[model samples]
Target: MSQQAALLHRSTHAIPKTAVGGQGCYIFLEDGQKFLDSTGGAAVCCLGHGNKNVQQAMIAQINQLSYCHTAFFGTQASEDLARFLVDSTGGKMTKVFVISSGSEAIEAALKLSRQYFLELPTPQPQRTRFIGRTPSFHGVTLGALAAGGHILRREAFRPLLTKKTSHVSACFAYRGKKDGESDADYVARLAAELDAEFQLVGPDTVCAFIAEPVVGAALGCVPAVPGYFRAMKAVCERYGALFILDEVMSGMGRCGTLHAWEQEDVVPDIQTIGKGLGGGYAPIAAVLINERVVKVLDAGTGVFRHGQTYQGHPVSCAAALAVQKTIRDENLLENVRRMGEYLEAQLRAKLASHPHVGDIRGKGLFWGIEFVKDKSTKEPFDAKLGIASLIQDTALKPEYSISLYAGTGTVEGVRGDHVILAPPYIVTQEEIDIIVNTTVRVVTDVFNSIH
Candidate 1:
């Protein structure tokens, strides 16, 4: 019997190759094959695998203290990580709630947003609803899942998800914007739609408006157009609803900014960050609260009614702090911007004119290529063909030895397909060339096979 027989994998029919080790930009399988990690394992390994700094930090923390329940004791690791995150925001975000994953961070943000309203001097107990955007992915946990609009991920749990959440059209320009609509007009239209949704749901009854700064997974790496987030935040402000930004896949230097919102000209009332936080060295994520929300809670409850056994794991915090410091010390964000431009140019120069490639968009080291059945019409391929998955599988073959992140339901809830290429912050021009070249070959081969 296979050693993996007892383990339940994502797919039961096929056992995935065991990843025995990784370093820098490549992962080595048990069979000794090395594959370039273009997608950062869902865009998490910002510093890439096996960083000595992060590993040593985790080891040091473990030796000092590995487990300290937040309720009983506080560790220096957690406090330092929190301070570093708040300082990184330039004190715009006053407090940080360290957690174990992006899902937990989001769940905490949702609960905190609701609690903030209740703790307000006016005390809006009516604010029980949350408004999110369609084709957006927050997380998989119940609260986070309900707060998102990833139809396929939410399908099985539709009956269990909260009915209080409603969705508006995503700020996806490729398929969302009208042919002749100006950027200002497109922003206005989306803002108006959000306002209408708030009104329909009773603006006063909404707790917050949640969305990713850049749409990940469900819609691939789709960033909002200029002035898009500012307009949405304005609507949320008008309705007295907190604005929540989930930067799990786009922030922490993924988009050439430590915080993705910095580029959007807006600040979130509450923000959830993960993925690159620990650089895959350990599990860590955080919920950042602005002064407005922090002040309210301080004046009223003085306690956030949430707890997790691993709420502020010392080893995780240490790992994340080291990752952040590495990014700062090495000035990787600058590299991300420079290499990101090179990547975008290479991808467009090579694949933009392909018959099946429809749109290429993203920021920093993150990018997505949408495949279409009819380029002129922007029609998506049939869902059953699984173009994104096919491209991923093709890219991972021995000849290619590259990994790409795939996504479906780019058009509405279930049609369009896209694949994301989010390389590590340490990625170079040479690495970018390899990634793009492999992507071109894999995409070309996949489409040709189907044809």
Candidate 2:
């Protein structure tokens, strides 16, 4: 085995079989097992696998000019990609900063938010803290890790993590809502918690409030209760803190819209996107800044002060441009909405009333199933049970052939379990049925065996 195999086998427990090939909506193992990739490989493959256009785009770019440093020359592909991103936002987003991964996009957003405040006079020198929500996931990068709230993921690195970040309760209505609270009241309470956090830290002393429009990884695709984002955005505005939305997993076409915030009706000052942005064709991510945020930099600093040699590389940009155009030209977002409704119906009809299923929630093709010890009580499994961990494994059985993205500590940072299933936008009705049937069977079997 190569060092890659050894490292994954030893360091990452419960690693899956080798994915020798992937096409359309499935990944093939070296042993000839074809796993239905309902999770779209972490919701990355919006264009499905083995997209010919994206491949050709990459090949042609590499053949022409593979590796030109951004320091010396700018690429047409990067410029075109920027135009596409900005235009996708209806000109609301004026500028696009390219980066390598979701984490890098987040790192850039964090830096940009801080720099936004720096452009302000005196800029409230004490405004160094960042506000995030419990059970939120930003990224693994240092700045992103500091902003994230998963207790287990942030434990060992606490010393190295930034100390100024604080967390508020997430608007997870399934678990966090009061017994008899209305949606309006629940959103109010969460907003109050955020307001209190800002006050506690002195609003002017905070840099930005970061959150995923739809909670990914940590909370299993939980969208905020109605009015949650509006309230949250109001609070941030009141405090003079920029609202940063991490739509890395939920944005692009995953949520049936170009921007996840579009559904919420409130745009962020700085938005981070990745995963489906390039449809997993190449490593690419970006930070989309609104005109207001960019104006501060242009007027005050005259520069963003952030750049990487590969920041706007030609090949990555070309791959992403092709992916975005393919999505738009193919009219896949409509399919996302239609198929999303079907998937939701199947999940609800098949699994919602199951004894251990706590919640089934998502938007567009991105969806999640939360498991619990008792659905009636909304109590979570003990972390040691590893409900999420085992589901991802059992679903990949030789006869079954499925891949599920498992997440734990969804309730807080160490007590709940859920598995996310975001299939490719190109998925057919037959494939959707296969995924639903396989997942429901595996999930039901897991709980029955455990109970």
Candidate 3:
């Protein structure tokens, strides 16, 4: 049978069908099934599949220089990509450290944050701990995992993870906002909680406050309230701590802006971005250091004490450069905004009235639909129900032929159900309609069967 399965799959007993081909938001299975990629493969395929420009760029780079270590020589592809990213930020971010994945980028950010404090004239090595939000996701590596607040993902590794990082409540309105609390009051309350945590941890001991501008995965596409980011940044500033934003799943025009923090009127000292950076064309992520931090480092050590073998892979950089250029050349950000409004309207019109649908919230092209057992009570379905997982499985059925991003533990990282929809920026009205119809049908069928 040609070795039915030798690979260790995510689930020990279940092996997914092999995908042989994909193009422009659709994946082809070996069994002649075509599935619509509504979640854009975890929101990474921003430019969709089979992009000729990105492919050509990668090929060209390979023909010239495939790989070069940062410790030795810098390639043209890497330099150009860095310059493009810095210019995109209007020089707000002065330097870039290209890495292999989002986790690595976050790791770099954390280390750089610590190093920045040390590089200052009045060094405070006591600033060693980090503060992140509960029900947030940073990355999967130990340091990054420790910084994240995902209960389920961190459960097994809790004993091994560092305890230096602490967490506070996220600025999630659907569940976090009380019945009578106004937006200003909610922001104040959250800010108070953060300030209290800093005091509890000893303000000088905290290094930075890290969070996703738009919470993804752990709390599924939840955005902050109007004045939330400003308040959080203020708290960080008061403690003399760096403000780090993890835009891995929300940056690179995924949220209708080049940077998710742009809409909030808050600038981060250090930022990490991935997913859409290379748009699934190659593995690439980066850490963007603001001028303030770069200046301190340049005056002191003049070197970041970190190194990776493939720190700035030329071919990967070329692929990402090409992908980013395409997003700009095609004016996809405008399409993201226009199509985002249309998609949200369609979703609300179709599913907002469903008895189980509790919340439909997001910005730009990123949206999350959270399901509940009782709408009036805002009570989430039991974890044992695996409601979100069921919907995702049903979405991929041959009859439906759709892919969804499912997340669990939305409420305090223990009990909640939600699915995210982040289609490619190039998605059209027809594709949006198909996605909406399929999602509505899938959610309805899953709940109907359970009921």
Candidate 4:
């Protein structure tokens, strides 16, 4: 039997290489091969592997207090982390709920939004519905899954998902925008569609309108057109519904901003952040509650009716606190903005002429390259071919030795392929060249082999 025989991996038949250690932007396998971590493992490793600051912080917290049940007592680590997050928002967000992962943060946001309605001076018991954008991913947990509109991820759990959630068009300009349509017109049309959905579902019954400022996995790193989010927030405000932003994959300086919504010119009532929050140093995510919702709850319940066994794990909080501090102190966001421009320029310069390269879109260090069978038509390759998977598999080979985050169903929830490139914020320009060159080679190899 193999070493992994006792383990249950995501794929039953395939066992992945064993990673012995990681340093900076590279991972070392047991077999002595090294692979450059290009996508940060689903965009999680902002500070990259074996970061000394986060490691020491985790070790220090472990020595002081490893865990603390939130119900019994709160630890200094959690309090400090929460304070840092709130202060990061310039006091726009007043409260923070720390959790274990992005999915849990989203679940907490969902329940909190629901409870916010009940805690209002005049309870909106009927406000139980949630509105999300199609081709968007919030998380994999049931509550987050229900609020998400990724068809493939939800198909198996259809019977288990909540029926109270509805979806509208995602702010994906590459696929959704019509020919010759101005950005303003596209934003207006999407806003109208959201308004119609609210009217269709009875606006009074809605609890929140949740969306990612930059759509990650489901649609790759697709950002909204200017004024799109402002318009959507307006609709939610007009209907008295809470606005939530799921920044799980694109927040925490991933987009050259502390919060992705900072670029969108809107402050969400509740925002979910993870991935980059802890920078893969510890399992942690958080929900930031705005003053508007905090006041309502403070006036009424003075408590959020939710609890998790590991809601604020001290070690996790300590590591995350260190990660945030490192980002701020090292001026990494500035690097993200500077390096992001270079990465985009290099990608476009090299791959723009590739017939199979459909679109290259993103902000900061988060980017995605969608593949197509017909460049002029923007027709995605047949899903069965698994273009994204092929690129990912080929990129991991010893010859190439680089890791890329790949996604299918980019066109919708069933028929497109794209790979994301989210290098660590600490990445240098030389490393960016390696990533770009390796990516071009891997992509070219895959397509050439296919033909």
lDDT of every model, 2 decimals: 0.93, 0.90, 0.94, 0.94
State the local distance difference test value for candidate 3.
0.94
Better of 2 and 3 by TM-score: 3
- Candidate 3 lDDT over residue span 1-451, tens digit each: 1345778778877888889999998889999999888899999999888899999999999999898778889899999999999999999998999999999999999999999989999899998999999999999999999999999999999999999999999999999999999999999999999999999999999999999999999888999999999999999998899999999999999999999989999999999999999998899999999999999999998999998998889999999999999999999999999999999999999999999999999988999999999999999999999999999999999999988799988887999999999999999999999999999999999999998
The stretch of ten residues in a row with the least summed lDDT in candidate 3 is: 1-10
Point out where model 3 deviates above 4 Å: 1-4
Q: What is the lDDT of residue 141 in candidate 1?
A: 98
Q: What is the number of residue pairs that collide in model 4?
A: 0
State which candidate, 2 or 4, has the greater lDDT. Answer: 4
**Which has the higher lDDT value, candidate number 2 or candidate number 3?**
3
The digit string of per-residue lDDT tens for model 2 on 306-405 reads 8887898789999999999999999999999999999999999999889888899999999999988877788888889899989998987886788789
Q: Note the clash tally of each candidate.
A: 0, 1, 0, 0
Candidate 2: which pairs clash? 127-205
lDDT of 1: 0.93
Error of 3 at 44 (Å): 0.4
Candidate 1's displacement at residue 73, Å, is: 0.5
Q: After superposition, how far is residue 329 of candidate 4 from its true place, in Å?
A: 0.9
Q: Residues 126-179, candidate 4, lDDT per residue (tens digit)?
A: 999999989989889999999999998999999999899999999999999999
TM-score of each: 0.99, 0.97, 0.99, 0.99
TM-score of 2: 0.97
